[model samples]
Target: MNSTTAVTAASPPTRSIRWALASLSLSMLLSSLGTSIANVGLPTLAQVFDASFQQVQWVVLAYLLAITTLIVSVGRLGDLAGRRRLLLSGIGLFTVASALCGLAPSLELLIGARTLQGLGAAIMMALTLAFVGETVPKDRTGSAMGLLGTLSAIGTAMGPSLGGLLIGEFGWRGIFLITVPLGLLTLLLAQRYLPADQQQAKNTQVAFDSVGTLLLALTLAAYALAMTLGRGQFGVLNLALILLAGVGAWVFVRVEQRVTEPLVRLAMFHDRQLTTRLIMSLLVATVMMGTLVVGPFYLSQALGLGAVEAGLVLSVGPLVAALTGVPAGRIADRFGARRMTLAGLLVIALGCLLLAVLPISFGVVDYIVPMVVITLGYAVFQTANNTLVMADVQAQQRGVVSGMLNLSRNLGLITGASALGAVFAAAGMRVTFVVALALIALACRCARRH
Candidate 1:
């Protein structure tokens, strides 16, 4: 039998499928947790290492940069190699790196270890989604996507509080060390339960695209640095980096078009549906980041709430997201992903419009209500969009496509952090949400067309 038939035949039983999904969900959680957990420990790290804020921030930036630059490349590598094997390797690497991070004696060593950990995270993030199609029935793909989404949000939401507690109990090292046991558990489950790769024979027929991978990685690095450096203040250096990224992207595209086994097929962009979904993902992510960038300031500066109160209020969005994710996926599975995608976009647009127009005199309730709407909508949009994108992709291409989906979201987050944060700083929350509204409107239009 062929690979497809083999994959179908190898589908895990119900109990095994649950174990496999648990592994995938934990993988997603660990990767996302790595992203946010370190943020909460930056100040502690600065104090412990006697490093300046600028130097210590690299602890977070190094991880972010590594993941952003290498995610797509690693995903393509998994497509060429066996995903199960690569994913197992990734989990092991992450676990070892986490231990190194916890034991590092110098700040530089910690940062270097974090970069390694991020590489592992890049693999985990890319492959977990790819594995869904292999592990789950086609009709349950939406539910699987939703569960991953929910775990991701939980990880993000849990990071700050969990990191704080760990730091208080065991110091900054605890934050990194906390994931070690979880990583091992995930590795064990995945190894025993996930369907084995049947593509080793086919893999021998294709050559890995080293040139394309390198060019893409370098281009992504330049772009991420351009968007993340300067602390939201655009400067000559940022401009230069942006220009470098543009040039690198042009070169990469040319290389991709020539490579026998391109990292990303240039022809994929020609698919209107895929292109549209990617754009919508980017736009929605940008708008979602706006709430994160603008929410705290709006709560504190505008409404005069204290830090703790503001944090409590801010947590509501992620809470709503976690609650809504599974239901949203089920809805997508039942009603259709395309329709749910459009509906979700429209809901987000309405919430943004309300945030922009509502009077401040209405106070915290006004903010909370709209944010709940936006978060709920975002949960639905994310699940439906992911389901729609992954549903039709070829099995061999799922890893790369999943990586692209993630890459778009990362770019959007970086852009929003820099661009929308700047907008809020200059023109205030109302204007920022107005910009967000415009973005969601564009996303809605794209969804409609799709």
Candidate 2:
């Protein structure tokens, strides 16, 4: 069958489409929830396990590192195998891992379980976006993307509060246990509603690139560790890891050029549109991370807000993102994706500028209002940018491309936390936001050139 016929054949009825999207949204939510929920319980975990802060931190880091290292590999695997089968397996693995995390007797065991959970999350995050192309109609792609974005934001926004409530009521284990039922529900929906994977000719089957996968995973892990270790203090170890990551990346690229079946085709970067979108995604994510890294300090030190007040104020950004996500997607559908992408960048720049210039005397409203604008723009940009990228991807390459997009965002967040947080520590809130503004400006320029 031709591509058009295959898509038409694969596209379910409107009702089934909604159900499929629901399953995908839940997948996104669960992955994001896994990321943010564990953070709140770190102190409790340290106390419960009688471990040092550094040891307890692995509970969060293991999950993050697993997702970062394996996301691209899993996405490629889904492309080779079947996204539906892999995604079902991912959901099951995540559910089982969560149970294991809750039942673990030691901190080491919990971290190991979290690693397993992160692998599952990596699969979910990678495939959910890829599935969009298969499940949703072309015209409504932005709306579907927006809905997924909304769920992701909701997961992030609610995680800390939900985790706190769960920990308070049922202890740290509850945070992990709570998702088991949700995971089962999501798995059932996905199995029932997601379209079956299309069959490929036997002659066309390509072997998985184990060497490339290993190199890429190792490279990413090294880079992530470089950025995260030492609590933002760049020491000799961080420098060594960074150099190692650089060398690994070079080796990975060389191997991909020589391999018969590469994990990621280096030629994909030659597409200016794809390259620009990935760069823009990374820059935007870095800027967004600035808000997370710098906002609390700005609130507490600059605005003199207490911990509770600062947290409440900080939640505004994700809340705004969640609320605007669907509407932003609908707007992207009405307008062109490129135009909306540019608009979103500009809005984010404006917010950054306001954050830089607005006086401290204006108090919390100043921060909150600008944050609302920034997050709203982020919602629009993310939905439109994702729609723009995925809308044109070849059916066969969707999974890998989706994984690449997510990897860019993850890298950007890691970079922002380390780099932007350093700027905040040294130069204070105003300078940090100025740096954010510059990053957004660069993103806007890239969007316009594209």
Candidate 3:
């Protein structure tokens, strides 16, 4: 062999520009598919396991809670270790967990398996963005982020339909089975195509804040419990736990201030831009995520659609969201996140207005139009927020910050779901949508000022 050939063979090649983007897209798609696929399987799992509605709800809740809680922690951890290493480990764990979930005989076992799968998902998501940051060229970073957002949106959009089909044909196990090969493919692609960019952060002396992590987890858990249980359901013991959690959160804040390397950097909130943008993102996710739960129920119950049909229609928003991500990110990079976010909020408000005004006998076109508009708005808002969040932070801090964003949005989703559910029970879907629209309008005001 020639000397040049020999040299090339021995050394790692520089990343092909497209490969990094391709890898990022694939990883995100695989990770997102897990959430989407599970939603479809929920009904089937409930039937097969003979679970009550409340018990079956845990199947979705467990997954969301686990991923939401652990994502930031895992992201911070990935910085100390290696993104690639953590990414691979997460993929392997997720794949195995998916397989286990498929085989689970009992509802309890399935929930447990799903929780493990969520842990893996947290790792994968944390690394995917960090990986993009490290690997992609500066000009292309926004586009990459956009594409990642889009893929995730697509996965979410497709989730119900995919789950419905698989459940219909092969049973609930099919949902878990679907993720297995896709995850394996992602792992293989990552191994081959991912850049060899492993720049460990300099402060090896820095340690993870384990105490703070535990306290924060407790705080969120307490809040979630309070919301889920409601005041009526909470016993004396549950009330005490909630109080304890409040105390823990206060302690967590104190502990975080003292730590050299905190799991959540309290200082990031000091920036007006970062802080306001974060609030907007959180609010949007909360309202939008909550709306999703209502959509399926309304379509299936009030509109007389089958589960599969309802899911398919429900997927429209997410699909549009995914498709819009890259373009939104690109625009944010060029014109600034402020404008993109404002426009998105406005569009979302409009979509909600459309939903509120729809006739009692409105056809598919009526619903799909509003859903698509809302999703497109969601894509723009999310992409812009993501870009802005990462823009000011240094490379070394990206993982932790990224994790923080994930935590914020998930918290919003959890809160929205619980709060909106309560609202739905007390009032009605129409009132809930109208109130949510007003909230979105408030968010738009915030976005405009920001």
Q: TM-scores of the models, in the given order?
A: 0.98, 0.98, 0.88
Report the Cα RMSD per candidate.
Answer: 1.4, 1.2, 4.9
Runs of candidate 1 exceeding 4 Å displacement = 1-11, 200-203
Rate residue 141 of model 3 by lDDT: 56
Ranking by TM-score: 2, 1, 3
Ranking of models by lDDT = 2, 1, 3
Q: lDDT per residue, candidate 2, 307-393, as tens digits?
A: 888889989999998999999999999998899999999999999999999998899988999999999889999999999989988
Q: How does candidate 1 score on lDDT?
A: 0.90
lDDT of 3 by residue, 1-450 (tens): 322232245453455546656766777887788876776566677788887778887777777777877788888887776667778889899999999999998899989999999899888887787776666555455777798998888777777777878888998898898889988887887877765534445345678788877877778777666655543344676677679778988898899999887888888778777788778877888888777867877787778889668766876777678668888889877887768878888888988888888875877776888888888888888887787677556656677777877777877876677777667767767887887798899888887777
Q: Scored by Cα lDDT, where does model 2 land?
A: 0.93
lDDT of each: 0.90, 0.93, 0.77
Residue 250, model 3: lDDT of 87
lDDT of 2 at 246: 98
Error of 3 at 146 (Å): 1.6
Q: How far is candidate 2 from the true structure (C-alpha RMSD, Å)?
A: 1.2
Candidate 2 segments exceeding 4 Å error: 1-5, 9-11, 201-204
Cα misplacement distance, residue 182 of candidate 1 (Å)? 0.5
